[model samples]
Target: MILHILDEEKFLKKAIQIFNDILPKDNVYLIGVNNKKSEIFHERIQLDNMFYVETGSSRYKRVFQEYAERADIIFFHNLYKSYKLNLYSLIPNNTKNVWYLWGAEIYGLNPRINNILPLTQKAYNSNLPLLKLLRKRVLSKIKKNYEWHLFKKILTNKIDYVLTNISEDIDLLESYIPNGTSKGWFTYFSFSEQNFEDRIVLKRNNILIGNSSSETNNHIDTFELIRGKDISQRKVYVPLSYGDEEYKRVVISEGRRLFKDKMVPLTEFLHLDEYNSIINGCSILIMNHKRQQAFNTIMMAIAAGCKVFLRDENTIYSCLKREGFLVFSVQKDFGGEDAMNPLTEKEMLRNISLCQQLYKYSTVKSRIKQQILSILDEQDKT
Candidate 1:
């Protein structure tokens, strides 16, 4: 059996589906979330053939160690102190291990943890100088130091493969991961192969800026960039449903201050239907993440035929552009008349088609199956 150690995330549902579809059999244990929330979340994810351990119980040890050591392969979706149960060292030396380099595990290794406080113009830290000092000098260091220990101890020590959406991220972690760890690429979503006829249209109507209150979204800078433009014809919507609480307040304050009543701040997490409603209604989507974040929303916006804007610095921009998707850059292509225009019908159709073909579940499943089978074959030979 292959054991999948997952974080409590929406993507895991898709991951579970893909794994179950490809792997002969699999067991899943979701950690990185409160045990109290487990059953409800399990229902929410609509999970099966899986389990999670209560926080204070010894069940984790008995469960994790038993299946972990017995499994033919181990897949880590996140790195956390739960290592006390599923230590990479405890698994059989022959067990093929694949570490999915989800963005947080990689960024946690950064001292800043992808903090975008600078773009807030000191509005956040200025009010909480003492709090900022504690975070900068004490808390941040402690967090990164612990994560560095995990990086050196588990990730670099014996992991066989590293999986990420971007090769550039693999390059970024080159120095930290061991030389022998091979690369495998995976994106969270799988697109449908169904053919559909819908013309991409952007009339510069409802606008979406940033997906969360996370500092990396740089919501303020995104706000500032579009502030100079005439948005009288547009209504700006910012998704702050989840992420940093204080940062959410900061984003909401600045967003309203800049865009006034035209700005709609999403304070509560929206259900799928409500969220999709906003996404479908919007014609323009602007994201200012310095790192690769809010990818699900970004891709959804693209598939919905929304005129998407991303920072040139984000590797996704390069990747999408390379894949022949019609995407724009926030810095060079975000302001004035030209920025608001939608793709031509041909370009829109091409983008929608390209997205489905490139990320088709059938293709992704085949790729994942091949990668897993290669490892199993290697094991057989040895």
Candidate 2:
């Protein structure tokens, strides 16, 4: 089968792995939207037929039109508002268009202003617990928006299928797209074989935190707000994309002064091998977004046996909780109102203990891989 994949950043690695593993015997073609050099490198490493199209947004519609006619299926990974999948509108109706909703795409904008504004006004008028009400409002909005968007898109589009890494994700998607079937898939954003053995040995020293994309600005803000508040020792590492110097400067000036020796910034993109090394070397992974999106950084930490901390009440958090993973925290007290909140020291220790337990039993990689294989087999029969 001819498959055309379009995406940005490192997610292409996972898509390529899944395509090769599940459809090894079938004819497959890999295509990248931008970064022609990286696409060429990716093609060199794999035996399957691969091609790269470094077309800008202005030309994508025209380019995709030609490619779509020749291909049987089109797969989009990490596609958002910018690299609009509306280009799929150009694809021939007979060619299947598959959207792999990894995480944030399912959940709309952070804080979900549409849902939170009313709750904020209500909380102001009423004398209810403000933080608790806010949390409820925020979570409710995420669930409602996630369902609305996924359902709307699935019903409106000519999409043949929706694929995700976690089974719980399938549940969330099916809640909206009742006709949608689960296509089991996993990401290949883990430690390389050379470092796998070393990663298994858990370390309890300074916590290592990193962020690469702009979507994580909320997380950066929360960590800045809590900096030097008696949490576990932290060493922040940021891999800034090209022309992100302004963001880096602002984060450094307003937040905790990152130790110059510990800071890691990327002015240009690095290959997957180098990126893996930096991610594998980290200890704990931290994500503090109001809406807990499915981030590969957290997954990489889990694969490397590192503790991951995120907001507790979001859909992703709820899904992880059901799976027996304890890697989340809900913000209850921000200011003097809840000053008597639990100390960060105690919470950090508790989180560490839970991390150990989760690492012992969770093999997310294997479960996800099996699901992807099953989905592909079923798709083949159809």
Candidate 3:
């Protein structure tokens, strides 16, 4: 049996469905970590093999242990949360483990080639809760304790596969896994379920800014960059659907103050089709993520013939450039009098071709299916 553990992201709902299509229903089991969100997920999926834990309940450990015994493979959806550290300790030394590297979890911990430690330290030193920082420090010390490190090293050594498309992520994950036994794959962006098409070339006008309300997007700086530009006629759309609410409110306030009627803040949840329509309307998409966040949004914008701008420091910028994408860097185009530029026909066609080649639904679906099946085959051999 394959036991899949997930955090409370709605994308994992679709991810679970993809797994259901690829694997035998009886062999796959899902456990959601957050109670309220998991209940909502259960309502949507209603899967017999799925279980959501009741917070602070005695039955939680019992339920998880029961599934753990039956599971031949334990799959961690992402490796960020310390909540699962205790649960991971319970898995027998024999069980094979797999981890999907979400960029934040991996890159936040491992900057690869970038010297981001000073910046990160400075950010942490700002007006964050003292108790929270103290608690995190204490936790870090505990995790670094010799006995705890030995235990963690044992568990990490059992990680059979670390799944990620990013080369830096692979290197970081391998550093933790003993003997560097973890295998890497050029995995597709597994969460995106958009029906990608070559959007008709039009006179693109509006600008799409920031993927989320996360501080990683450097929203304030990017907003300042475009604030005084001669593009009052152009609309600026910011998707503040998920992330820090305080940050979202700040972004909305600042955006309105800057663009007034032209500022569009997507404060509420949007259905997939609705969001895609929003993407289609934009001519320029600017994501100022310091890491590899908002990549799916960037790809969607590219497929839709939007002139996408990402920071050069972002690892994905170089990766995409290597893949023949016509992506512009914010480092060069820091600010301009005319910030809103339409994609030329030549640029549009090239972006469309690249987007389809890399992220089209059929390609991702097939590759994921093959990768998972191959993993299962390897498990059978063992």
Candidate 4:
């Protein structure tokens, strides 16, 4: 039996699709950390061999041990700390274990635990108050020092392989691993292959900006810059949760005051098909985070053939640039003597055009699928 632990619905759907294609027809079992509705919904259509696991931190150890005893291989979707303490060390040494590095688990919110306060100070100085608040809250809830220690502990385990969606993340992992060869670190692109008939009719001429709440800090300043420029055509779409109401209200209110009738807000959790349709219809996607552990959403938008605009300094932009994916623009800080010079409109437009062309040529989605399958194949061989 192959044990697959999934957290998000999007990832669960994609993983199930790939596992069904490669694994023995009835040998795969899905253990989800989501509600029963999502698990039943996913299994109802394509994954007949699926098994539901309730979402929790304390129960994971017992559940994982029970499943690990009977399973030939175990795959954890991401290297979360709860899993690190419960499952990583407890899994039998003989069973092949694969760790999938997504965003937060690897490149954490700050450079180091001690740097959290300083990072928030920088955000405040940069006129990104919203981001500072969000960062502060996250820092308070999850201790950076403790998480870093847990992350290091998990890395010491005998993980057979590490699969990452971002190529840049391979280098990040290498910093921690001893034998830092590509043999253990696999680079895969981000892609979701759920085919949706294009429902984007382009009813309006607005640029659509979509993000999860975790990214508020990175994007707050960019939105401010665009707002100052009198850019009237802007729409913001973020998935809503109870904790995000205050921040969401602040952002939406600011956008409305700046753009007037041009700003629109979408806050509901959209179904996959509906979300895809909305994103596909957007004119451009913008991300302005100073440091992003991973920018899967940007890649997903690019895979959907949408033009993307991102700050040049981000790790994701740097990696995309190295990969020859011309999908971003670098914003330069102009203070002191260099204050007079800034990026020209023509230069920015040229980069956006290049990004659109590159999107057409890129096989990001296929690359992700290939990496997942490769991990499964390696597990089978061992």
Q: Pick the candidate with the highest TM-score.
A: 1
- Tens digit per residue, CA lDDT, model 1, 1-382: 7787765656666777787788635556555455555423234554565675554356755676788777777887756444432464565677787788766655655664454636674666664558675786687788677767756667656678888767776776774554568888766676656553443444447889888777778887777788777789778999887667788888888877888899999887676668877877788898887777777788888777788998887877877888788899888887657787666667667778887887778887888888878876775677
Query: Which candidate leads the pack in lDDT?
Result: 1
lDDT of each: 0.72, 0.50, 0.67, 0.53
- Clashing pairs for model 1 are none
Candidate 2, residues 43-139, lDDT tens digits: the string is 3344436554454555566566666677655665544443444454465666556666665554553223321223223323253356755765687
> Model 4 over residues 295-320: C-alpha lDDT tens digits?
65676565555556656545677777
Which parts of model 4 are misplaced by more than 4 Å?
A: 24-48, 57-59, 81-84, 109-142, 176-204, 215-217, 233-243, 293-296, 303-305, 330-382
lDDT of 3: 0.67
Best of the two (1, 2) by TM-score: 1
Global Cα RMSD, each model? 2.9, 9.0, 4.3, 6.4
Task: Give the candidates in order of TM-score, highest first.
Answer: 1, 3, 4, 2
**Candidate 3 to native Cα RMSD, angstroms:** 4.3
Tell me which of candidates 2 and 3 scores higher on TM-score: 3
User: Looking at model 4, which ten-residue stretch has the lowest summed lDDT?
Assistant: 334-343
Q: Write the per-residue lDDT of candidate 3 for residues 307-350, one digit (tens) a residue.
A: 88887767678778878888888878656544467778888877
Residue runs of model 3 more than 4 Å from their true location after superposition = 33-43, 54-58, 109-155, 172-179, 186-198, 335-339
Query: Candidate 1 has what TM-score?
Result: 0.89
